[model samples]
Target: MQKLNLSQSLSQKLSPQQIQFIKLLQVPTAELDTRIEEELEINPALEEGKEEETEQSQDDDFEDSYDDDLGRDDHELNLDDYLDDEYSGYKMQGDGNYNSDDDDREIPISSQTSLHEQLITQLNFLKLDDRQKIIGQQLIGSIENDGYIRRDLEAIINDLAFSQNIETDIDELEEILRKIQTFDPAGIAARTLQECLIIQLERKEHPDDPVVKHALLIVQDCFEEFTKKHYSKIQKRLDLDEEGIKDAVNLITRLNPKPGGASDGLVRTQYIIPDFILTNNGGKLEVSLNSKNAPELRISRSYADMFDAYDKSDKKDKKLKDTVTFVKQKLDAAKWFIDAIKQRQNTLLRTMEAILNYQKEFFIDGDETNLRPMILKDIAERIDMDISTVSRVANSKSIQTEFGVYPLKYFFSEGIATDSGEDVSNREVKSVLQGMVDAEDKKRPLSDDKLVKMLNKLGYNIARRTVAKYREQLQIPVARLRKEL
Candidate 1:
């Protein structure tokens, strides 16, 4: 049996233009140029460079032409025959203007070899059997960027068997690893910090020297004590005086902890392109978007003239009609994109203006302690936008100030309550905590409990766990690790 059913349902959907704008809003300044280039390649009617007419004239012409054409109903002209993304009837094509300076603007390529490549080059000097050579290469590949092989030997053996069809045990791998550790870098493939130090210490020019021997002993036997700065305990066990231990500690400290990092000098540096530029003109902060963000884009003048010609003709010819359909689609897309760009520019400025106004004190004085406790909701209310919009801006955007270039989100922090009934940014508390740690005696570092008590006396009543969390965020080690010889 068949039954006919009728129901009405209502749902909201975003148009293609809206989806594109949302994506564009999230593109950081580094990538916005790429996105614009892609759009220019695809959309023929959308071209770069402003129209020769004045801004007022361009707006008047856009309002007159695009609005009239885009707003047409079927009663005036039929759109039954048109091209779309899936439609293969007609193809729209436009020649792109490639900027010659773009090539010059790119960062120059480096000719220096990377660390792993150098390791492989050294492997050529080893005289091993075919199987042994393969295992050696695999071991070198397993080494991390920091030149340490943290992976388990057994796991690597299994991987070699499964992936490379090489059957080897841990002893064979360990033997080969010892050879790799002796490579030119002094401590290339050590498994741990102690091993890395010992490898370097053994390679020292005067290993028999008293200071060198003591340094080796400290790294090999008293590594736990060395890391915890328990020099007195190490001295008692090794029967070394304070002067000898101090010299040994100084020698060990002079050795490079990260051998692989030495090769990074040849690597190219990364530069951050800020999305917003904030200048303090005599304490009056002026906010502006990056110049790259405000590219001069306009409707292609030739395409506009073609549309005018098409409108003048009462052509019943199919060829003329086909051209009209293609032009209409491109024009519509161009106008939508232009409008979206304008909206995105306005939205970015509005959101950034709200943030600048809210954090004016911090910007003017260049003091992080003055930063207020702010969240997305606070900016959203001021700018009359959604919290999500503010989040999108804050997540990827950065501002260059007199003090430094900072990510926009760095200004927004969680609040902590003080005993005086005032709210302060958690960043302020972290700053204070860091200051105390910096001033503490290295041999007597303050524990988290002590830090909490000190902070309480300073009027910030936070828990011990919170103190530990903040210390970890600041990259400060535990009290034991902070001790010195």
Candidate 2:
């Protein structure tokens, strides 16, 4: 038998305290308030309330007594000693006053119905038998928010048989699904774009109208070519003129691609809480984190009181000893959390300051042209921190400027060297490309090669493939697809 070494080298990892700090740093301002509430709930020693006048007087007296013996050096105070010090230095001064009166305000919970829920609610009014109702409910549930049934029919049939204990054939199911598709929102349960349009056209009161009927035929038979904007082939097949093709294309364009998205009385607006706020004060750009999102968070005073009580109690008593140990553990945890939050704020401010300094011109003028090439390494080098740390700061953070709020990642772009031997942001090049495309004649669209030449003439020195990649990134199609009649 071979002799084996049993020992293994295990590297020390970050303590729970350090990990908590890193997590806090990653949380943006919008979610900071919720984290504070969570901390308050976990630590009973932590309480949220203003200190009474008598307590404040006692604190002042204690601080005065300590200051007389310790002299004027405040830096010697540790984390615990600092909290015991009169809450003077930490108090928000002048314009930094936080409104404590609205602490009791209740956040309302709205039971807003989703699109599918609304559709299901209407399904109840229809007169259908028990089995048909069950099938309709299943079909309604299958309809996605975009009004498409992307699920495979065979799988659905299997689900109904095994899960719901109901035997259903594809022919019968398809019939009911067609009826569900004809519900209030025209194309509710279509599996494809072609099916969606056909469902709507079939339900039309004037089904024989030349334009409507021709558009339905075009969608059913030549959908692949039609979507590619191959109007000449369609015109040749139908033997129609340019005006007739235009009428059919216009009719198809008017149909709602996402039928479920147009539900009335149900409006959903996304809330955008910015992490950083940038304003111009006397021609100087002033940057500050949105303090409203990050409420004033500190260790609960109740926890401090419990700690004090434990310290004063007799050490010989077993009950007191156990209580002291419990209180110490909780107090240590609370202290670690408070320190982590402070460190997070410091890191965030430092990282954002470096970013603002690097892109001062872009921030001053809300123009994409003013943006320069910047990467995580650039900011990390500027701030003398690790690239990974800088990346964490940028990942989820958002900045609000006079123009609009944008994620921190929006400012960074890879650089491309121009003919003048100067490096420019790829974002700037993309903007230039988009502008050129917007100005180009749709009847005779500019090809990728022509765009590359134009960009080179303008000193960008980009290859044809690079131009094509940029164009595709912007979702602009090829010249053939972009062509018009």
Best-performing candidate as measured by TM-score: 2
- Over 306-336, each residue of candidate 2 has an lDDT whose tens digit, in order, gives 4444434455867656655665676667667
Residues 225-262, candidate 1, lDDT per residue (tens digit)? 88878888999999999999999999999987877774
TM per candidate comes to 0.81, 0.83
Query: Which regions of candidate 2 are displaced past 4 Å?
Result: 1-3, 6-12, 47-104, 203-210, 260-267, 315-323
Report every candidate's CA lDDT: 0.81, 0.76
Top-lDDT structure, candidate number: 1
After aligning candidate 1 to the native by TM-score, how far in Å is the CA of 32 from where it should be? 2.3
Q: Give the TM-score of candidate 1.
A: 0.81
Clashing pairs in 1: none
- Model 1, position 284: C-alpha lDDT score: 74
